[model samples]
Target: MRRRLIIVLCLAVVLVVAARLVMVTRDLPAQLTGAHFEGLRPEPNRLRAFLHRMPKGGDLHTHLSGAVYAERLIAWAIADGLCLDPAAMVILSPPANAPAERPCGDEAKVVPIADAVAGWRGQTTYDLLVDALSMRWFLPTPAVPSGHDQFFSTFSKFNPATGGSDWQRTLARTAEMTVDQLRQYQAENVQYAEFMVTLLEGEDRRRLGEAIGSEREPKAMLAALEQSGITAVVTQKVEELRALVARVDEMRGCAADRTRPGCGVQFRYIAQVNRNGAPAEVFAQTAVAAALARAAPSIVAGLNYVGPEDYRAARQDYRTHMRWIGFLAADVPVALHAGELWLGLVPPPDLDFHIRDAIETASARRIGHGTAIGFERDMDGLLAEMKRRGVAVEIALTSSDVILGVRGRNHPIRTYLSAGVDVTLATDDAGVSRIDLTNEYVRAARDHGLGYGRLKRFAFAALEKSFLPAADKQQQEQKLQRAFAAFEQEVTDDLAWPDWLAAFARALLPRRG
Candidate 1:
């Protein structure tokens, strides 16, 4: 009886200690931020400030080409002495054998970009070009009736400024663009990014397509590519990318003692394959992308299919494209632009199977846009499979709303979360959408009613689902944890009363009388 009594006393003591420990380690920051978030809905400025200070982990679905602002592109064009077609708001190459006095040629139809930007119609031309390059103040019209058309067409419109014809100039422009994006991300406290970029171009790209001509069998095509000295080309492309990275580092002053914020942020690339090309051309690009990924796994992390998914070539060759990706990317990782469609955008049958085929056939580790998840057949089953396989969906809220008209309750973000599928917020084309990562988090909280805790999960999900290596991922996870802790403490500190005010209140309190 005495021994039993002693044992019960010991159990009681242990329970008391455990309770004390829980109290000591309670998350005061999370609690404080939760209260702050609850009160922020009524104030837009405060809401933006709060989320802006919050740490965003990474953006995994960004397109490099579409991420540059129109103003910067125009500046580059002016520096190159390029011409502009004011009617189309498109940049044109300088004519050959052109006189130095008129570098853009003496044609009345085209004027120098510099002249257009500073002439009598300067402001008007500038505004039109900026609006044309992005979705700002857009409305349906006779020429470009759909948001979809306007969004995709912006790429070709600004292609000349992005170095459409000159390979050396293209490299320099790409490096400058990358540095610009990284610096922007750093200002918002984003720790990492995986940019989707197209590395092959010009004669090299043409030669690879010819070598892969008319080959239907995946293995045979891969074998032919191997025999066609594609390795040398891949080597050259890899070196070019390395040079680009070095240029980005130099521009950002990464090697200096006093470095820019962007110097600390980690970045990787995913080679892009254009889906609007001919079958052989598409296959050739895919093979080259796979080779690039394999050759430089550290720099080129993976491959993705870009271009509008509903294009004539993309829709007709969807299955074949999947097969190509499935076969060529056996060992490499893939993220596909699947189910970016909507009911009115395409025929009903088109939406039914895209997400499924991408997951089941192409082995996509991540799905971009995924706006048509509701229209996809076996919605519940597909969600289940995605959950089972750990496939993450990259949700671009602003881009989807602007380009596909998918937002609010109509978006499948809630559905995916309810079904236990992992989802992360991204900026599909930050410049094109005129938004950043913070804008996406704000949209999630304001539009979808996501609370602080749930939004935090989305930030962490981006890092966990990134294609970064395991060791690098772990390092980034640690950095994210530290950033959140500091951010939450700042919020709590803001809520605290001033020490002098507290003393004054204490002095005014009633005495023990």
Candidate 2:
């Protein structure tokens, strides 16, 4: 009889609390389902909702080489008939079946195409590594130096067949493949707020330096490509870029239901020019970026070259590259992939200047990675400048979490945040690094000991800090403001909170109950 009375008393209390919640909210969906989490470990569902509605902006610091996984690249290679050597672990050109010379790479690290495919089917470590390529956005460091090298070197293997592989056919095929993967990801809870694309292009210095028509050396090749028509080639590239960006945008924003409105996602472009390119090449590429920025609306951004960190040839051209960017960016808005260095991979001087030159000269409104900021001199002063200029720094949380631990509470991220330097989270090479923004967010919150408020603020910063235009960014800010107001009011107004929060706290400590 006593046990039955206790159960009835509990039921009555639950009903009274439910009634109180209805009275307070008037009629609204309960956001914080903390009541649902009765056990010791906190409820992550409420946390997930909080993150979902957090109004996170787009990811600005993304890379193409590391963005696409090696497995996908190898898959593309195998589809083209290229095979990987088991012992050497490098992808062969023209595939094994039937073709001419194509670029191959260092034998030691990467396996051949056929061996990889077989190993991949049997779930060998090679297959595991290849499978890991697409997952780079989420996973912890996968042999950082080796992975980085493998990622960059795989380019040579893909470049050759890419030309002979019926360029149009290959592009369309890749588009389909990209769409299919995004769909699969959606089914599995991968959320994308926005995507920015950077296409890689190499420039011809000697020819561009001489002038548009002066093909004095490598005359045969120059004659063939010129006959192929520069305007036509540029158009083709632009069209291909448009299609690819369209596909990515569509994929990222694809909804489960046609009738339902979904998240805000926009697509932007950046024309990447390598920092290590020859002056002539760099100048020409910059001109192309300016032109594209002028020509396309869906594409309103410019960038150039990606992996200068690996190019031993351009060690002395940092200032020259900055100057070239200045000339090119006189007509367009750009973001530079700057300061992504460490003590070992880049020389000391490079760590000092790459971040400095990008800001002082290149007119780069945004900087990707900027990991070496801790290593740069006068960093505090730089942070002040960044705060004053409102030049936001995009931090690759997925990548950084793997490498950076607490350099103290005032590590690079916290220092930037505390100093009022706008900091954003990014996934530099999601596919290769095997990580996504969500995982980055989770890790950042846990590792950095960040509160919900701080994480949401960072999400807000990431979007507004994007190199997107003033009008679009302003619109996004307003939308974010509305969302922020709602969240802020919820936290501040305890009465407005779900009755469970108040009831639970009250129950735990009541006055003369």
Candidate 3:
């Protein structure tokens, strides 16, 4: 009799919750639903603001160097006492009157920020550097001319500012960058970010390469590499990364106040392999990434392979690279950038296998880009398998449009969604692409027909598929659920409707005579 009463009480509580949810949902603007999402086409600003306030659980795909805006990068360059090449706008170490590459001719000067501060031309030069360092300069009347080339080229222009050879300086720069980025993301209500951070240097690369030299057998190679004292090197770097993460957390006041802006964000790093490097170079970096992740799982959560997929080295060694990752899959989490190519960008055959190899071979839990999944062999089967395996695809809608002219109907977002494969929207290179996580959500809603609920699911999936440990994941999930509930109730409380938007919503509903 007691058990029956308990069951009856539980059923009544569920009914009450269900009824309350229906009432709350009814108070929300009808346009927030999948059916009415397309109607937001005309109110771009309004939709952007709405999504900005939406709780984005995490950004699973982002590059640290590519996340910071060019303007801030320029300021950092100036403060670092770096000089700028006026013609190419490249930042480098300096002497003001140093000879520069031609095109600016013999008169070209590498102006120091201190020197520039005293003159208007220096300030003008600073303004111009911002454009040269990012897509901000591209006057896209139609589209950016050679955007693919331009996008990749931006990295080289800012590389000198990152303090090469000095991993400590790199860590400092990264810590500083994270604070800035975390503030921005938190303003958009993002709770977490997993930055693709590179931790290798020339010496470590050479050491690891020589140790694992020309070993054909995977087991032998793994054994030889392990015996090579590479773990000692990785340990040092892992300590550096941990220190950096701690410094960044302190800057965000994470240790003092969890509720502070940017403090609430849980940031982690992923060691990135430069996919365009030579076979030895690639494998060595992979070894370091795998080892480092295992050594410092808290600070360095996983590993990723990053580079243009169409590059000759990355293209030819694609399978070889996947196998390398496969060898370490048991130890490291893989998030490979595969199928970032499009038609005419590479031979059609190239697109067919990149994502599949990443999935079937590397066992990547998350696939970044996966843009060309439609062109893969047996597309339907692949989609089914992805769904079965629970491999989520990180979709960067804005970056896709900027790089491949693929967006809206041309994008496979709907295809993935319909296939029951989990899809999470991200800002791949918000700095380079001139976008934000909020804007990506807005684009997905406006262009790809994702409603508020679908957007929420994507946000949740980001945290769910993250490299965070099980316990931390559960804690974050609980916090995120609470945040979402609070946000929904706030929205439901008054609808927060402005007079114009309320009228707009009413117009979409049936009229009463």
Candidate 4:
């Protein structure tokens, strides 16, 4: 009877000890991570390394064309035998009547891209090309006087390489770009991405717009688009996108090894409708985007209106565009690039309505670069609506800082969070901005004084607020949770035993006999 009593007491003690250990283990990693974050605050490189390995759930605002580095674009241009305008730093197709060997003709100013990047002077030109193709070493100049101008101008400069006239080559380029971005995201520990790409371009898009003609009414326009065989086009495009993903898988060797970096990173597209285009063209693009999103929710996650929000056409027809989206994409998810504007970038009135209209009219699930939220007409009500609807705001720190000069306290990230609105970090144009997702997290920490817990919430919020289907999103969230567990445990292990603790433990041990 005494032995049984002792056994019961021992078992109770074990249970109590185990419970204590479990509680300690549950909170230990977070405590250690917070300490590590604070310790590494002064060390930018160490902080970046810490954040780089941390799992970022998703990059929901990336642009496929802008996500690629300039060096890769240059390589593609060389491979395609394209020309370079030295002074302009822009890629151009071969002159029509030029010989195959002399694609740029005998014009001294226009040299083959390969030739332009060769030798000593070529090295200098290559540097300039990289700068011209991105925001690297950018400063206000006579020709490109504003960061906004320099930022938007890069598309035209690199258009020849990315959007060539050859359909097959363009598709190949798109595939290559997708693979490149996937690899990049994997490297930065981004588990998922929703790349904004123009899937319906070239002849099909133009024809659809031409068919839409003067059909201003949404029902009539959608019917016109349907009668114009847009369904067939969407079908073909979906298959083409599937093939593109297959190509990406092949490129990443994902079929052979599921554990490959790019293989583990899942992605989907957000079809981009260029707001700078004519009204009919924009309407046609929006219609096709809506249809595509509905037809392939798994592949095409959603639709977003891209291009400069402050452009005359975009501003003038902003409300009309929202109305059109409201009608066409009633059931489809929308993530409009609203409120990317700033005070001087546009008139004050323009800022007041873009974000409001995006949510109230277009029913945007997310807002990309919502930098102008503070300038909206009903700021409090807008925040309330965003919070109530659970509409997330995608914040691209580097993009906002460089393009709109909005960063630090000027940024609306804190405001969004304070209002209970979901906020996620993204790389708007990582390549163009010369930043990765880690860079954004680092900025959030260093610039905004966010701790590890807040940053982790951002990571989780990215996946939670994504346009992914319920199952996919849940899977991604589970993956993110696993990643965080591993990451935190690793951090705890690294930080749990300091030099003093090790020394003390060694001192406490008995000497060898």
TM-score of each: 0.91, 0.69, 0.87, 0.91
Pairs with steric clashes in candidate 3: none
* Model 2 spans > 4 angstroms off: 1-55, 69-80, 93-121, 125-170, 173-236, 239-264, 308-314, 401-411, 475-499, 502-513
RMSD to the hidden true structure, all candidates: 6.8, 10.0, 7.4, 7.5
Q: Candidate 1, residues 443-490: lDDT per residue as tens digits?
A: 998998887778888889999999888999999999999999999887
Give per-residue CA lDDT, model 2, range 1-513, as digits (tens): 999999999999998877765544552322232221121115555555445444455566665444555656666766666655554344555323332343234434444455455643645645644644433333335553444455555445444333333455545544544454444334323323333333324333344443543332333323444554544545656787787767655655555444222323444556666556555454555555666676664564666446645367455766666776776565676677777666777668778777777887876777777777877789888878888878777777656434432233434777777788777777766765666556566656555656554666676786676656789778777766666566545644544445556434543321220
Better of 2 and 3 by lDDT: 3
For residues 1-513, what per-residue lDDT tens digits would candidate 3 score against the true structure?
Answer: 999999999999898767655653564543333223344458898778768887899999999999888877777776776666676667766654545443223444756645554477667776767777777757643433677777888888887566645666777898888898898989999999999988887787877777778875777776776788777888888778778877887788866778787877887888999999867768878888988888888988999999888899998889998998998755688888988988989988798999899999999999998889889999999999999999999999988887788888989988888999998888988988778999899888778766666888898999999999999999998998888777765554544456435544544443221
Model 1 local distance difference test score: 0.87
lDDT of every predicted structure (CA atoms): 0.87, 0.56, 0.80, 0.87
TM-score of 3: 0.87
Q: In model 1, state the lDDT of residue 404.
A: 87
